[model samples]
Target: MSSGVEADIALDAAVVLSLGMNRVLGRTAGLAGRGAEALAALAAGRAEARAAALAEAESYDQALRQVLERNARIEALAETREKLDAEVALPEPLRPEEQPIEELTAWCAATDQALDGAERRLSERLAAQVAAEIFAVPGGAEGLRADLGAPAPEPTENETYANETYRTLERVLARLLPDATADDRTAVAEAARLLAGIGSPEEAEGVITEVRLRVGEANRRTEELRARERRRAAERDAAEQAEAERQYVLGSITSAFEEMGYEVQDGFETLTAGEEGAVVLSRGSWPDHSVRLRVDDAAQVRAAMVRTAPARSEDDRRLDVEREREWCEAFEAARERLGEAGVRSEVTWRLAPGVRELPVSDGARQTGTRSAQRERSREREK
Candidate 1:
């Protein structure tokens, strides 16, 4: 019974330490365990037995605490690994299966910081791209940056109002630029260059208010000009705008494939009465495989894996299947690349691997279908 009490006291001390409490053996809270051990020693009245019991309790206490501490660390490391796994791909050495808990925790912190920096850089690049699209003329990203001038310094607390006011002015001026005269636009740009040095709201209010008045005047002149231009402009159908937008989107898609080192042939006809929009892309690496992008009237885009040459043997068939699988990966990557280029796309439908039905000779099928469609269109025109 005395030995049992001694063991229980030692276990209780370990429980306390496992809760991350301070070392309890020599402290006030440890008195109960220590007193029990001493009492057991005295009651047994055998020096050898007492020494053995003390050694046993001390060993149990140390072992139990170590186990509990290790368990806690393992639990924490596991949670960190799960979060990192979901956030980004784990590096080779930091992967949980590759190393122990201690090393993973140390490496994950660095990886998390690196991911943060990468995301920030990507965000800046996207912002710059958007700014170029809206503000720059064709091939004018660098010129637009020059026109916008250098970035303003961080505003002090006292200059917050002034800074926000300037930003508002800049946004409104940019929106009005399409209608404003070159001279008026230059005036606004010059004002922006000069105002970049001003910090006080009082000093900026006059220049900002003057810029606003100029923008309002420009808007009034634009309305008047549109009234005259409307009389001279021909009435156009809605399909014209839709076709232009479709062509623009197709151009972006073509650029994305070209950037991927594929040769693009965008024979995109206007989506008039019965036209089918198609683009073909091929790469030298896979001479026999080509990707056909089909855009219908509804503007839904789909990629077909085209086997330019028919398979003559079983080995050729196997190679064709492998090539199709590779095209699936490339098609998905192309969509992602389009997003980076500011073109958003969503997959409406896809046939999974081993489920797709491909024609024996896609090249022949494509040619016949396109020719027949054109012949029908010509008949209709006649």
Candidate 2:
């Protein structure tokens, strides 16, 4: 294969790998849409020189893989730190910055164990509080045992065992209640109120059973809800980050053109505003010919040289193969400019110069008439 074709194949492989890795990272760590930045950086390095060797392509692949792996680790650490801050609420906030991966992983494991201990302590405290409230009432203890279908307590040892069992039940209920739905919580609250004012034996008998069942179902529903939310959050973050990166890339393209001495109008919103996507127009390069660039919704940019004024005859409208070849060179230069700014240009298809006799027309209006036409042509080819 030609070197150009080889380089294109290598770049395509890199993109495929990047996309696959991005999906894996999204599933594991909620990190997606980060591969674009790595690809752009790779393009910048490639721009140092277009090396045709297969070895250079292998180097690009290795560099991109390394970038993505390192980026995933860093972002994962940051996200874990934020989550710990929000849920654990440590007395002194953790400073996870600049920490090595091994150190961060160790810290996360240690903190997780500590959080388990803390939750156990809290559960015990809640159980104690419930016990105190129950004993404070005259027949509360007896009523609770009756509610759970346990026999009434005797003296001393049996009574102590009964008290401990009831406290354990309270602790279990408390642990699951946090993950319960609003309706489940309401049911628990109602049961608490009814238990507090138990004037009869029948009422106390079923309250505990009702609470246990409600919380059990609620816990399951809550798990599903949490998973769905996490997925949605990852998707949302990916989309927003993708758009931000695209805008940054678009801005770089605009700047690259401006640096090449072309006038750019920032016509990204042209179609909605009833104009075409004619972002750049050349001046003073050729008396009757000018180069124009149109960017579509997908941010694909096309450059073409056209007549400066309306063609007055059929010959005037005829294609100029020499000019077409010249414009191709200019287009390659534009891609190089984008590479300098750390953007990748993937040329999916191109028409060879002088191969087909196609008529040339007047340049696209900055207000966007012909630019839209070119955009449609590009879409059809795709």
Q: Pick the candidate with the highest TM-score.
A: 2
Cα lDDT of model 1 by residue, 52-72, tens digit: 655544554444334333433
State in Å the error of residue 197, model 2. 9.4
| Candidate 2: worst-modelled 10 consecutive residues by lDDT | 1-10
lDDT of 1 at 332: 69
Model 2: CA > 4 A from native: 1-99, 114-165, 177-179, 190-210, 255-259, 268-278, 286-309, 313-324, 336-343, 351-382
- Specify the poorest-scoring 10-residue window by lDDT in model 1: 1-10
Instruction: Give the CA lDDT, 0 to 100, for residue 47 in model 2.
Output: 34
**TM-score of each prediction:** 0.32, 0.54
Over 1-382, each residue of candidate 2 has an lDDT whose tens digit, in order, gives 0011101211233333333344433432211233444455456566333333223334444444343434443344344345323232322324433234455455555655655554444333433344445445676555243232235456476456445545445644565523345465555545554555544445545655665665577667867876786677667756754544445445655677677666666443224453354554554554555555555432465655555554456565453556566667656776787664445677866776655543333232442566668999999999
The regions of model 1 sitting more than 4 angstroms off are: 1-237, 268-275, 360-382
In model 1, what are the clashing residue pairs, if there are any? none
What's model 2's lDDT at 271? 40
